[model samples]
Target: MTIKPLIILPDPVLRQASKPIERVDGELKRLADDMLETMYDAPGIGLAAIQIGVPRRMLVIDVAREGEDKQPQVFINPEILKSSEERSVYEEGCLSIPDYYAEVERPAVVTLRYLDRDGKEQIVDADGLLATCLQHEIDHLNGVLFIDHISRLKREMVIKKFTKAAKSKAI
Candidate 1:
């Protein structure tokens, strides 16, 4: 698997909704492997296909702590089946957003269903960091960023900062 270049913020591609994976074929599986490689290299817990400019409803997550064996999870066309009324807050940073982070509140628990690596359907109940990560990545699939959950002022500030940084780098 190859490590793909992550698409940063202000890239119009990141705002486009991803298409669902029609089948988990060899190419899709390779993409998933590449995503896992990218996520680990980013030192992040989760990553969505859109972050790599794929624009497909796919994500890879590995919540394992340092020193532990990697437990990679692939979600193909995932959908949240249930979400808790109670909320939990987590400081979320996106691969697309780079260094910026914002505290976003979401359901404390969630149940999601999706196709696994083998193309078999599976459902998993998640909470804590996993729940937050799943929600955040899934949001990317829908063209939503974690900053959208924060105050408008903060969101604009982040966008402006990234936009400026990107411009400077382009010089």
Candidate 2:
């Protein structure tokens, strides 16, 4: 599978809410494969379809740490069905945002309903890093970012930096 170009921060496409896939077909499967390859190449634990300019409610995640067997998972039209009141914090980074990272708080546990790669429905009860990763990607499907969970000052600073960087690249 070929690795797709990641859409970086400050791109308006990254802020658009993704549309749900009408069906999971061969082309969709290929896109998912490409996404997994891109995520691995990015050396990131999670990636959203919007990050890859797909604008679909899809994501790929592999939270397995280095040296462990890669456990790539594809989530299509994912939704958080339930979440715990208890909070957890993780220093989260995004493929779209590149090198920047910051602590973000989310539910310690989440129950998600999503379509698997084959279009089969799957329910997952996730905790720890997996939980955080799932939440982050789902936010992308909804036109949100991990930085949005941070303080306004920090978020604005990040947006400004990326916007300037994007402008420089255009010059």
Candidate 3:
């Protein structure tokens, strides 16, 4: 598996909604493997397909803390089936957004339906960081970002910063 180049913030590709996988085949499996490798190499807990310039409905996550045996998970065409009324706030970061992080409020518990690596259907009930991570990644599938959860003023500021950073890199 190879580490794919990340599609960073302000990249228009990231804002495009991802298309669902019509069929989960060997090619898609290879993509999931590559995504896991990329996420681990980036030292991030989760990554979405669109974040890597793949406009497909998929994500890889491994919330295991440092030094633990990596527990990589793949979610394809994931959809939220249920969400709890209880709310929790977590400081969320994205691989695409680099070092920027902000407190985002999301449901504390979630039930989701997704296809596993083998293309088998699976439903999961998650809480804590896992729930937040799932919700965040799913947002990417819908052309949304963690910054969008923040106030408009703050969101605009973050975008402005990234826009400037992107400009400098192009120089």
Candidate 4:
């Protein structure tokens, strides 16, 4: 699988909502494989399709701790069905946003429905890192970013910084 280049922040494409996958086929499987490879190479725990310039409802995640066996998971057309009233906060980072990280609050437990890699339907209740990761990636499918959950001032500052960085690279 090829490691695809990430679409960084300030790229307008990241703001576009992804379309749901109509069917799961070999090509889609290949794309998922590539996404996993890319996420692993990025050394990140999760990645969304939009982050790689693919406007599809898909994401790959691996929340395994360092040195533990990799447990790569693919979610196609994932939808969160339920979220706990209890909230939790985690320091979240995105591959598209590079080194920036912030603590974000979200539901501590979530139940989601998704299609697995083999075109089979799966419903799972997730907590801890898995719940947070799923929420973050699903947000991407809806054209949302982790920064959107932060304060307005901080979000604007991050966007402005990335905008400037992109400008310098273009010169």
How close is every model to the real structure, measured as TM-score? Answer: 0.98, 0.98, 0.98, 0.99
**Candidate 2 local lDDT, 1-171, one digit each (tens):** 999899999999988999989999999999999999999998888888899898999999998887999999999999999999999999999889989999999999999999999999999999999999999999999999999999999999999999999999999
Please give the lDDT score at residue 122 for candidate 4.
100
The best candidate in terms of lDDT: 4
- lDDT (Cα, tens digit) per residue for candidate 1, span 24-119: 899999999999999999879999999999999999999898899999999999999999999999989988998898889999999999999999
What pairs collide in candidate 4?
none
Best by TM-score: 4
Question: On residues 1-171, what C-alpha lDDT tens digit does candidate 4 reach at each position?
Answer: 999999999999989999999999999999999999999999899999999999999999999999799999999999999999999999999999999999999999999999999999999999999999999999999999999999999999999999999999999
Q: What's the lDDT for candidate 1?
A: 0.94
Which ten-residue region of model 3 has the weakest summed lDDT? 63-72
Model 3, span 1-171: residue lDDT tens: 899999998999988999998888999989999999999888799999999999999999998987789898999999999999999999999999999999999999999999999889999999999999999999999999999999999999999999999999999
Q: How accurate locally, in lDDT, is each candidate? A: 0.94, 0.94, 0.94, 0.97
Residue 78 of model 2: what lDDT? Answer: 97
Candidate 4: residue 140 Cα off by (Å): 0.4
